[model samples]
Target: MKSYSVKELLEKQPVGDVVVINGWVKTFRSNRFIALNDGSTIHNLQCVVDFEQFDDALLKQISTGAALKISGTLVESQGKGQLVEIQTTDIFVHGKADPDTYPIQPKKHSLEFLREKAHLRIRTNTFAAVMRVRSALAFAIHSYFQQNGFYYMHAPIITGSDAEGAGEMFRVSTLNPKNPPLTENGEVDYEHDFFGKETNLTVSGQLEAETYAMGLGKVYTFGPTFRAENSNTSRHLAEFWMIEPEMAFYDLDANMDLAEDFIKWILKYVLDNCNDDLQFLESRLLDEEKSKPQHERSEMPLIEKLKFVVENNFKRVSYTEAIDILKNSKPNKKKKFQFPINEWGADLQSEHERFLVEKHFNCPVILFDYPANIKAFYMRLNEDDKTVRAMDVLFPGIGEIVGGSQREERLDVLQQKIKALDIDEKELWWYLDLRRFGTAVHSGFGLGFERVVQFATGMGNIRDVIPYPRTPQNAEF
Candidate 1:
């Protein structure tokens, strides 16, 4: 007899063969049936045991959350819903969980309650399925990039330059916090710090990946990025993973095409490969929305929503046009929008972005050519001198799923932008070198990895999809 994982045993279904398996018991019903799970699949393998044969101590150890090893013969299950069962002949208790002390029970628990038990939440069906899908999505992302002739680049985590220019980054230093060196101006002297100058965790890897793209022709980075934004919303996180891809000689149009195709491809992969987990998630979402009013419920099931994106073409509209639509739209005219859209050059919020995708367009929308003042300084300035070649991909549920642009390749224009923004040129001296020596047109985009996982899993809160979510003032695990 050989040990087999629950997933493998369930798939192979070798009836009449004796097998050995180790797993944590999910439930012990009537002292006869044991529901065994090994984090291999959402389903549990039912093991039938005759209580008369096992010792009283061993029988008591088969309670939920206890680890056990069993040797049994596989047979066709007399029970419904399951295909096969284990007829146990021997039992070994590896560990025991006191029923009164175990935090997880075989019952429905709220997401909020499970969040506090982050370390043991994976034993639940919901988190287990979400994590499995997250893993599949990660592998699919790499597969798509590799098959499309893109090199994976590893960007540095700590840097002296601000990539997003948002000035929201976690500081990385070894200096004493209570008393630190001060400069002549009475400011904290970063010169005496570990790096000799101020350094922080990178908020984005786009700037570094661009350097690689210029040399490698095409490159992508999938790594953890940090931000110090003090937002306590369900969508915000202090630390998250980012997927950024940069390509040389690609204009804004080419960038939009790549993003659209990439999103559709990866989503379709999940839809095809993760049917079981997705079905479970879809059912879970449907049950969750039942309490809400009819209007608040999703228009379609989770799987259908994903298929909608993969099947349909994203409607491409300009920022100017989107503003015009929002200005005259029913929401703005009726004073329903919280942040009303009035004119151009106004930054669009999540409400506006969601409106463009869900209400106005009824599909995924790609809004491009944003006003130069609202976008980052690195975007290519349009001929009108008022807008930049920046674009955002908006989905039905989430506002901005992806953001990218054709970078400003003109050395003079980039320098002027940097100067006007009051950024220290010394920090980005190496970045400017690429332009001075051999600059070519390049474009890239940053996609929030957790956001995608949340959308795919139909998980309402962004924190639930990630394993160990790091948020504002909440690092319990």
Candidate 2:
């Protein structure tokens, strides 16, 4: 008489109780067994029915992908696969899916094929487990920040200032594109736009989160961020979620400490809470790697890889030292790197970061004190003036997992850096005011939510982890 989720029923194992369960039919076999799932858990509920008791017409309605509600008495399963199953006494068909037309069939479907059917892909075991783990990780992120005395802040999605200064942004305007207002010099005038000036989607919330951290002491933002870069790679996405935490009175070293500890805590939470989903994903990864050569496969199991990170201390190396190691390493010297690490100022690519984590150190590594020219304008300038107090946490196979820095707090020094980059001081006047009024040593880092999900789930493509991935020339779902 009471409806129960498969997860709850499985955990409680209310044997001999009459229970009502609502779910979509995964499979109907031999006119008796029905595999049903409600998207609450990865495991399906085995529903056994007596063929002679029900009309053939009613039994015909129970097909794969059909939504159904069934009331039955739960009993210990005589079958070996699962512990309990339902003895169906009554049935109701809420909806039916044509087996021929349903995109999500019982057979194996490619990840590429599933992406096209993004709306219904969650019905699959892989995506359902992935999304469940992703949901748990999101909760873990907020939990860590809240327990450590940090306030959650919401940064604006649309803004006039460019945080990254790369200038690749999706414009936000209500003006007519075909024929809009013009300036005196004949350029498109943004003065009369919706916000009365040019605005675009935010790339990072660090700048705005810094303002909140100045007053709040510790604050974090978990929200959507956009980038208009035209990258169609498996590792890139046009839109993604970022988890950024800003802390007042923290230096770059402290920032690195927080990043390492935060990542470990959230990962451990997933290991404990989402064991069923994680076990499924781990087995999936092992099967996926079977086609590849032995050298290409991961040495450790998926869960072990996560545990390795949580158990080990992240190796800390300066940018100069990392450069030295890469320069002398077999890959760089033998031209194995795709983007070769030539000099200290060269930005480290995914290959280089992977080398440091997977091959060189065999653990997570934190590289710091990047060259000023390669980093953004906001990082604190070191005493030598050549490098900024910036850091990036490199993970096994994932490369850069987190990036942050000790922000430039000295008003004069920050102004000099801003002028060197030729950024509009007027646009960032409010940001500069933080330093003018009550600036202290502050630091923060951003971890791409998708990247973390990819690593945790052992998902190969960045697109597979997100619900609806936005990529170059692709927004279908």
Candidate 3:
């Protein structure tokens, strides 16, 4: 009487062996068949019971969403759908979900509706498939870094410095809210705060990871990063998990190559390990997009799209070239763009990135050497002194999936850039010390983990890909 999972039971034909399985009833039909699932896999186990032999009181307890422990002999299914099923001999009701109030009913649910019931949404086939694929992808990320000799560094969540000089930060404070200590200039006294100074949630781990790379040769960080920007779009999340890998003695070209290869490796890994779950998601996407206009639907299947990325070469273009292309493109010439690309220094928006990746190239595109003023201060300034050695990887539907750049290893140039950008010199003194000691060429980039999951799963909203999406004014779960 060993406990077996539905995945294990389905995979193996234990024809005459009695196995104990515990799961929640997905659907109970005709007082005999119980569709049970344990979140192990997308497939459900069909448990057949004899109504004539079972008492009426016991049968009444087996309802949809009810948790039950069922012990039965596995047999070849006489049914048409699945290959195997369970013959229930004894049952124990662990918990019951009253159908009157259970939110996850057996029906097609809207993604928005499912977001509200985030705790129980995993019971659904779509979310379960997504999470399984997500797990596989996570493993693939760590595997790639570990195999390539990169130290997996854990950057602190609470940081004393702003990696991105944008100043969009969520403060970490333990001071009194109503009446806190004030300074001589009538400012809130941060000297008595948690860290004895102003501290905030880390916006990026790239800066800290660079410090490790200088010593370890190569380093990576996969952890939660926060932002206080209030972008309430389908693409924006206040909190996200990012994968950043830094390497010493690497130039911008080497950084671009690593980023491209890393993405392809993850895609191939998921395709190999999570085929069953990916197949379910592919079918889900096809059904979900059936009602949409034919012109708007994807030309290729989900799996084919992923395979295409792995098989093909990414189009690499410089920022100056991209600007020239955008300014003279059919969309810009015809004034169809939402924000028309008119000049070289204009920051590329989502619309522009999509135009380049989906329309112009019809493939993944990596744009590099961005205008220095448009990028972060840490990016290496080019010989022209106007552009930085920055790069962004844009996918067909998801614009800017990955972004990274070569660091300004020269202390004099970096200090000047920080000063010109009005960043505090004292705050980044240790970062500058890396340059002082032995800074050679170093480069890195970060890719949002949730966005990659969304792409792999063909999920529509970014919120749907993450387990508990922390968006603006929405932290309910």
Which candidate number would show the highest lDDT if scored against the true structure? 2
Q: Which of 1 and 2 is ahead in lDDT?
A: 2
The sequence of per-residue lDDT tens digits that candidate 1 reaches over residues 130-199 is: 9999999999999999999999999999999899899999999998999999999999999999999999
In candidate 2, how many Å is residue 221 off? 0.5
Q: Score candidate 3 by TM-score against the native.
A: 0.98
Note the clash tally of each candidate. Answer: 0, 0, 0
Clashing pairs in 3: none
Clashes of 2: 0
Report the C-alpha displacement of residue 311, candidate 2, in angstroms: 0.7
Instruction: Write down the TM-score of every candidate.
Output: 0.98, 0.99, 0.98
**lDDT by residue (tens digit), candidate 2, 204-303:** 9999999999999999999999999999998889899999999999999899999999999999999999999999999999999999999789867899
Stretches of candidate 3 off by over 4 Å are none
Clashing pairs in 2: none
- Order the candidate numbers by TM-score, best to worst: 2, 1, 3
Stronger candidate by TM-score (2 vs 3): 2
Ranking the candidates on lDDT from highest down gives 2, 1, 3
Write down the lDDT of every candidate, Cα atoms only: 0.94, 0.94, 0.92
